[model samples]
Target chain A: MTDISQSAAVPGTAPQRPAATLSARLARWLPRLVMAPSFLVVLIGVYLFIAWTLWISLSSSAMLPRYDFVGLEQYVRLWNTPRWHTAVINLFLFTGLFLAVTIALGLLMAILLDQNIRAEGVLRTVYLYPMALSFIVTGTAWKWVLNPELGVEKVVQSWGWDTFAFDWITRPETAIYCVVIAAVWQSTGFAMAIFLAGLRGIDSSIIKAAQIEGASLPRIYASIIVPLLRPAFLSVIVLLSYISIKSFDLVLALTNAGPGGSTEMPSTFMFAYTFQRNQMGVGAASAIMMLMTVAAIIIPYLYSELREDTHGH
Target chain B: MATLDINRVRKAYGNLEVLKEVNISVGDGEFLVLLGPSGCGKSTLLNIIAGLEDITGGEVLIGNRVVNDLPPKDRDIAMVFQSYALYPTMTVRQNIEFGMKIRGIPAEERAKATNAAAEMLQMTGLLDRKPSQLSGGQRQRVAMGRAIVRHPDLFLFDEPLSNLDAKLRVDMRTEIKRLHQRLGTTIVYVTHDQIEAMTLATKVAVMKGGVVQHFGPPQEVYDRPANTYVARFVGSPAMNIIPGWLLASDGVPTVAFDTPQGEAVVRGVPLSAETAHRFAGRDVLVGIRPEHFGLDPSGTVPVGVDVVEPTGPDTLIVFAAGGTEVVARLEPFDAQVGRQERFSVKAEKVVLFDPATETRLD
Candidate 1:
């Protein structure tokens, strides 16, 4: 310790120390200095805004910021509104169906493409093409495709199937299902890419050993391969949940929560109350509710994942 | 246990042929090692025998039944891979009983077989542990346990010990040999390590360039290699191939080669009468093993020692003979470099090969 302190003290009194220490200090502070702007921007933009929203959720702010506190009243009003109830129900329905169908279709495609198929690059590109577009683009494209007069119904009727009536997007009860279909189509390829990477990470000789052990292809995949893809499943679920909760642009471009406001989600509902309906306090409460739901699911997953990492697994 | 017969097997991918008309036969309960360097078609042949790869133009018989169109599961064979290939998610017991479960065997029978295999491999305490939790040697034992629980007609091992460290490889090699002796099942093992082939194999097939060069007992293959490639491949500090002339002196067949000191002749070479007669006064290649040279002050061959290396048990002296470097493993002797010495060659142990064809003359 004395030797280290001596060397450290010598550098301060040396004749050529100014030039050397200037370079050394520059080297030490350069990375932090370069990162400071973005760090400060995120500190204000994301975290400060979150704190502000939480405080506003406890206050009675309608058209502007108000400091007068009203504890839990906005939450009470948020739960009592019928449209908020519909939005909550629709959110759960969309999240559950979106998760199930995307995972199933994605894993199926990844497994099928893993069979040493021909033109696999072309097929993978085609499947992943939807993820390259913005949610607005996908929503608009799927809106036209689900439209009865312009898309599938008209195409089928042009082929002389005139008695067919395909109009799910026009009905309030079935409009959410249409939104679910469009969202699944947009993100299933992303899930497949992740699953494909996981599948490729497995040792090929395990499959060979399973084959030699008299396990059929499907049995091997179901029993051995799927269980090994737990990490991939976690990743897909977390990312898709985030997408489902923040589903604002897609709803606007596709259904606009129309046909009796049946397909309203928390994101669209939050936007309408804060900007259009002048109920900022209730809007902040709903946003906090969404944040809590996300935290509830993600905290345990992150805890386990980080605990595994620290244990050197 | 059953005999394995690979009859005229050939493997080709498009225009590139990897295995060319290979033929080998293993008796029941015999340990046959297919030994070769990388890309030498040994593993390909083993895969063909396991029905993992298709035979281009030949038949493979297990227990005298031709299984050309059978899948790997239909063939009653179990294989242990070099990577161990254990199911990472499953416990050791589950891995061992997977085959039995797929075959619809009873739970009691599966558990009994799994316990028996684990006990035999001395891994009873590891039955509930995942493969990721086991060490390399333990994982290898689990792989072997999985293979043996099936009680198949044959066992195939694809360089199973190559992934192990040297000391662990030897231990696992001994374990495999003990397993073979207790089971008495036909085994076809493929490896590139000559020592493993020498220690554990009942018969060895040394291959190169997709062709089997020599096939016999390990002792026979080592004593009388069929070609120059086999001579250089199967031994450490490989056999010396010296240019020499084959001729007879006083009705005794002899080999004469030039040394750095002088010309030397090794008499009484044990060649057949036909070989002696056919190769008289012709140039030939002489193969002498490093251990076949004995130091003698009054010996016939004079060598100028260039370098000396004393291993623990034997001293290796590198010398110039027949215009090429030669190594002779000798007993610990006080030999100085850059000094002229005389050494006697074992005449009967000397092998002669044809220079044109590179095959043994006799």
Candidate 2:
């Protein structure tokens, strides 16, 4: 690549090496050459888009890009909007309940499955099947199941008890709770699998020793097994937080910020204002807010995990 | 201390019988070592005593109470596992105090017991450190410390030193022996290492194929094994078993087998009256310990040496005898490979077994 200008300018300053030497020199860049495509893609696709959104949030953009700087005006407007306020509140409500309920249900299932049960393989596969479904599918399925007329309420009424009402999907105040239920159902199995692996990796002799030491089953798990599962718990929490922060598809498919924006989340708000509502600046600001939330939860966890990996446990 | 009685304890997993009619009982303060190779049901027998496995057709009595239906926790025992089994999340102090705490002992008492155990194990500095931070030998001490603080009636050790290095294993073995000496608690230790069994057990039960072949003091088991299997299992450089002919010479019994040199006769074996009468004209298997062979230059049992293994204390002379390889422990300076060595087998120590049944010909 440096063939023409360097040799012409230097005349005889540049020594011409043998073909073997040339190939050896080219071998030095072989690894970097092979790694370039993926590196370039990530640099453009992830960071470039991130930088573009950051700039858009700082500018006076409506449907398209504008050069005039607006400085945090879009953020102030987002804060003042009632629907955006509902979205942020719902995000916390969903994230908190989703995490708590999922971890609890997942741990219960993992402990049950760890009991050397018959048909454990089939039961594990059934429990884990929901994690294989996309959020779109889970959201759509739960929407129907929670429907007052077509699903659970109608079925319960048909079996008598005609006053049955399971319509959390339709109420403005309770709509966010329905989203939490569906999200937890879709993610609990993921947590369960990780927890189960952690449980299996423990030396079973520890349990035997505890039993011989006159510790009951519950006491053993409380004092020893569960505490040893800290790494699994941390990983599951971080992954669920990431999922909750970027959770646009599930909300869009199930509630669509529905019941007059009572169930709207930050992800849904960012999507609506960015693509459909012609307010790019507000959308970009909401997106940045969501990014900061994810980074807040994830960066320290990643730092601890990486640092532990380097230092070794 | 408690007496552990396994009365006809039979363990089976859905028709594959792991243990069959295993009957053994240890007196209070007896250190019983269950010695056997793998898959011999030695571990199953130990587990049966610990109430870890269900007894299919027998009763296990701990201090005269039938504990067949009792869970391991109610059996009033502490087990040191092969893997150390220390709760990885707990510190040394917590690990030691776990049993006492679970038993609802007062916090002060639990702390006192934990401190006592840590001091006893010389692990006072390691009380706050987790098991993962400890070395293997330290982990073993922590496991034993956990057992010690329990003050359980019986202590069960399931090959607790198998994971250590050779040098460490020896050190830990001595430490376990010393611990046993200090406490004198009734301990049932399981190991495949014959040396460990011989050195530690007041009563060693040599098991093979789910049957106790021999049960006695370590020296008695080594000197007078009940069967060919016991004879082969207990001694280091296992007892050399040679198939031979039995004949009586002036009331003292003698066994004759073919060596590379010719037919060699080992006499002066004192056989019981029944054995002498029954095996007078039958084939007898001679059991001779490797260490019992004396390096006599004018010895009658001549054999061609193949290899010399000097193990610091004694040289093991490997020789081709009859149709099988036999090893004799001789002085390091007296043994050399590729040369014939005449060694005298101690006749009184030469026990005989009936080849048809492999039972001792007493």
Candidate 3:
């Protein structure tokens, strides 16, 4: 009886133990299996395309990507183009103005709304509602408003002011300024929301202490409160600066490189050359330059931020 | 230094009155502590004095001038906040000199004031450090240094020691008292801590629901609280109030209390004859500090101890008196659980209050 029981137990236990181990292994791997599909998609869709684009920029690809061995010729050709020069200069101006104006307006609005004011919730929503619309929508709406005979000028003229010529969208020289106005309108609310959060995080006692120390309201903001908002300022500048560099849709929807390529940007030039002009080599080169510009701005910032986090600040 | 006066200050938010016709005045170099629990409007009264919050219905005068219409800056005061409120981005020197710089003091004078303040606070070595690098106590000192450098007529401290750990709080408390003694600035401080109020204030205004229940020197407030609320709120393990009916059968008043003795009538309860006559047959609240009770073999009431709390210095014996849980500060082993123990109140230490108004009758 003992022999039979031992033999039966050994056979029964053998399969059960391995089966339990196998199921446990499968359970451990299930989460990774579920995550694999999305991970693989992003890996190929983003990183793989980036690799492909880098190779194409180096190769001699004009009409349809002729991947011949060429060394920096496309880059050399890209730098010599006057339109590219105009796009690069426009990038500096647009980025500087966009960042400065957005931060200033956003900070001002945030401070105003923080005064324990009545109807604050309603006002915050009104200011931030523009952020919900796409940049294309902002650009299109601004285009009509900035049009000479059809928009704000026409409306004002009908109101009997004949000399009001608010027509920057029709002129190359001032077309970028129209884009700047629309861009600032769309993103200032986003910056304001961030600044407001930072402002709220400050201790109320600081302001009271400042007030009792004989500092006026303006001096408090200028000397104390604004200096304390350094992190918020950093975040706003980085976000707006890169957005300025990669501006495409706003310019396209509003002016479309209007009135002789006045508001042309790197993104616009890249699109125009790659698809319209069939200069794929130069287009890829310009795209690479844009990426480098963004990297030059962002890499150092991210490094410093990460370094501080690791240092346990 | 200044004589700070708050004349019938009334604060209301629409229909909800937070502070109702409060009044207190202090001479130069006096420390007045507004003591209460949270939402008792102590902080509100402090803010109204600091000109941080509007006085809905009163005038605040500092050094004889009514500062009713003046902004906080023009009021010539300094404030130390609970969080320290040191400018995080500035060094200790810059923080101390912020007010001076705002008043457009020359660079040399600003530097001299910063150095002098830093030296006075014994933080000369830490003058170049940012607030973030300092310990909690050091930050507290820096905050004090900032207030000190301003050299204003008055200083307002809003529960300044509350944010520190227990040990640090005690240390900082001593330091603050010393600072007050040396500087002699008239200070209006707000805190919810009874011990801090008792230890620091020359005058304490014990508040409840936005009104001052008792305003006097700390010892007077502790020994003779103006009302039952003041009696209960202003002590560590507050004064126990025994509720019972006053018996004045033969022109002498006695409060009859319940105990394991079934019921005991204690006579010679101290009160004026008019108060004794007025509440002859009604319920009266008897306020007894825990230390005023003692155990004796032939005491009036026999109490069964429910719990023992030995707090290192003395043991707290909790028992039922007049159908209320009352604690008696006792020598250890005087009372034990599940055993009947005889206790009696010191006749002279007993205080009487009318139950109807919760006010002291005499």
Ranking by TM-score: 1, 2, 3
Predicted candidate 3 versus true structure: per-residue lDDT over B1-362, tens digit per residue: 89988888899999989998898988999999999999999998888888888889988899999998888888878889899998888998889988888899999989988888888888999999999999999999999999888888999999998999999999889998999999999988999999999999999999989898888999999988899989998887989999887886776668887775577566777788888888888888888899987887787767788988998788898888787899999877645687888877787778888888888877
TM-score of chain B of each: 0.98, 0.96, 0.96
* lDDT, each prediction: 0.94, 0.89, 0.89
- Candidate 1: misplaced stretches above 4 Å? A1-18
As a whole number from 0 to 100, the lDDT of residue A216 in candidate 2 is 81
Best candidate, TM-score-wise? 1
- Per-candidate total of colliding backbone pairs: 0, 0, 0
Give the Cα RMSD of candidate 1: 2.1
> Per the 3 Å backbone cut-off, how many clashing residue pairs does candidate 2 have?
0
Alpha carbon lDDT at A127, candidate 1 = 93
After superposing candidate 2 on the true structure, give the runs of residues whose Cα lies further than 4 Å from its correct spot. A1-28, B334-336
Pairing residues by index, what is the TM-score of model 2? 0.95
Candidate 3 wrongly placed segments (more than 4 Å): A1-31, B245-254, B265-267, B277-282
Candidate 2 residue pairs in backbone clash: none
Candidates ranked, most accurate by lDDT first: 1, 2, 3
